[model samples]
Target: MMKRIVLCFLLIAFSTSVFSGVADDGAISTGEYDYGIIEWNSRNPSLVVEGGANVIDIRNYGRLEVRYTSIPINGDWYTGGIRDIHLDDYSELLYLDGITDILGIDENATAELKGGSINYIDSMQNTDTKHIDLYCQSGWSWLYDDEDLDGIDEIVGITGLWENDSAFTIGFINDYTFGYDPVYMNINVVEIPEPATLLLFGLGGLALRKRR
Candidate 1:
C-alpha cells in the first residue's frame, strides 16, 4: 500500500514539473522579455516566455528596481524620497532594464531586479524632470509614506497580475543623499503559481483514481 502511494506521488510530481518551465539564471540582458505578451513593458516583468508566445507566470521575483543616474556619482546610492531624483538636459528619460526578487524592508539590502541609467555620471550636467510609472492587471494599491524613514513607495496586492499607479509624479520620490543621487527602486511582485511548478498536482489526481 505504501509503495503504491509513493509511486502515485512521483507521477504527480513529474507531470507538474514537465508542464511548468524553468526560470533563467537571473541574467540581466538587453534582449526581449516575454510574459504572456511580446513587449518589455509587461506588468509581470519577472515572468518571461522561454520560447513561443506563452506566459510562464513567475512569482519568485518579488521586487522591481527603478534606477536613476546623477552627475559625478558612480555605483548605486540610496534615496528615501523623490527629492533626490535628478535629470539633465538631453539625458535619457528612463528605461526598464530587468526585474528582480528583492523586497524593501527599510534596510540596505540587495535585490534581483536592478537597472542602470544611460546618462553619464558627471557633475557638470543635471537632470530636468521625468516621471516613471508601474502598471499591473488589478487588485493592487500604491501607497506613499516617506515620513517615518521607511521606503518611499509600497505596492500591496492579493493576486492576479497587479501593477502600481504611475501618476505620483517624479518630484515626490527623488531625494539627494550625498555626492551621488539614488538610482534604484524596489517594487514588490508577490508569489504566484507558474506553469513550470505543477508536477505534484497530477500525481495527487492519479492516486485518487487508482484507489477508487
Candidate 2:
C-alpha cells in the first residue's frame, strides 16, 4: 500500500512538472495592434502579426514561425500597412523549415528581419526584391545559392549575415499577387541539454526503477 501511494504521488508530481515546463516555454504579445492567433505546439509554434507594428520576444523554443501581414485600413493601402518587425536576440539557435504565405500586404510595404540566428529561410512571397536588405552585423549569411535549378531554391549556410554575432537583420518588400501573396517564415531552434541536468535525470530514473 505504501509503495502504491508513493508511486501515485511521484506520478502526479512528474505530470505537474511536465505541464509547467511546457507552459513556461514561450510568450506572445500584440502590443497595441489587434493581431490574429498565437498558437503553440510542442514541436512547432507560430505567431501571426497583422496590420501594425508588433514585437515578438521568445527566449527559448523548439521552432518559431512568424507570419506578418499588413493591410490598408478602410481602403488606405498606401499608409496602413506593417511598418516593421523586430526579432530580438533572445531567440537563439533558430531554424526555418519552409516559407508559406501567411497574409497579404501592399506592394510598397516592407518588413525587416532583425536579431536571432536563423538556421534556414525557406521562401518569401510578394516581397519587393529591391528592398530586401541584410545586415552584416546580424550574422545573416547565405551558405549556398541554388538559383540555376528549377525546384525550390536552397540558400543554405552555417554562418549568419554578420561575423561573430549570432543574430541578423534583413529588410524586404512584398510584391507577389497571385497564390504567393503573403510573407511566411520558419524558424528552428536546437536545444542542447546541460551535463548536470542529464546526470540528475539519469540518477532519478535509476532511483525510480530500484524503488519499483
Candidate 3:
C-alpha cells in the first residue's frame, strides 16, 4: 500500500514550468519545422515541454511531459506526413497540468492522461487504436456521446472524477456547415493539482511494475 503512494506521486507531478529543450534547436512560429525530437536512449531520459515548443516527436523510450502550451500537429495536409506529437516505439507521453493544442499517437507508443488539458488526441489514421496505448490516470473515467448509441465509445472527449475533487472536461465540435474543419476538440482543465498527488494510470503498467 505504501509503494502505491510513491508511484502515483512521481507520475502526477506535471510541469515544472520549464523546458529542457526546444525542438533540439529553436522554435518556429507561423511556419513549418522538422519539429522537436527527443529520441534514442542516448539523450536525457525525460524532456519537459512546458512552452517554446510548436510540435514534437518522441521516439524510442524517450519521455515527453507537456503542459501550458499549444501544439498543432496537423501540418500541410496536401504534403502529407503530419508529425503533430508523434509517438513511436516504447515512447511515453504524459499530459499533465496544462493545455496542449493537440496530440497524435502512432506506432507502439503510450500516452497517460493524468492532469493537463488536451485540445485534441487521436491515433494515427493507419494504426490500430491500441498502437498508441492510452491510459487514463487513476480515477473514474468514461467516454461521452456514442453517436449511434453503439457500444463503441471514444476517449477523445473523456470526463471523470479526478483526485482532490477537481474535474476535467473535453469538448468537441463538428460544424462543417460553417465551412470549417468540422472537428475541434480538446481537454480543458480549469485547475488540476500539482501532478504527483494524482493517481497512476488506471490500467497500471509502468507504475505498478516499478519497484517501490
lDDT of each: 0.28, 0.35, 0.48
Measured against the true structure, the TM-scores of the candidates, in listed sequence, are: 0.20, 0.25, 0.46
- State the lDDT of candidate 2 residue by residue for 105-171, as single tens digits: 2223223343333322323333334222223342234344468386765434334433223444322
What residue runs in model 2 are displaced by over 4 Å at the alpha carbon? 1-106, 118-129, 138-140, 145-158, 161-164, 167-212
> Which residues of candidate 3, in runs, are more than 4 Å off?
1-43, 67-83, 125-141, 146-156, 171-212
Compared with the true structure, the alpha-carbon lDDT of candidate 3 equals 0.48
lDDT of 1: 0.28
Each prediction's total of clashing residue pairs, residues at least 3 apart in sequence or on different chains, is 36, 24, 10
| Top TM-score model | 3
**lDDT by residue (tens digit), candidate 3, 20-61:** 233443222223323324342213546555453434667777
The C-alpha stretches of model 1 lying farther than 4 A from their native spots are 13-19, 24-108, 112-165, 168-212
Rank the models by lDDT, top first: 3, 2, 1
Candidate 2 vs candidate 3: the TM-score winner is 3
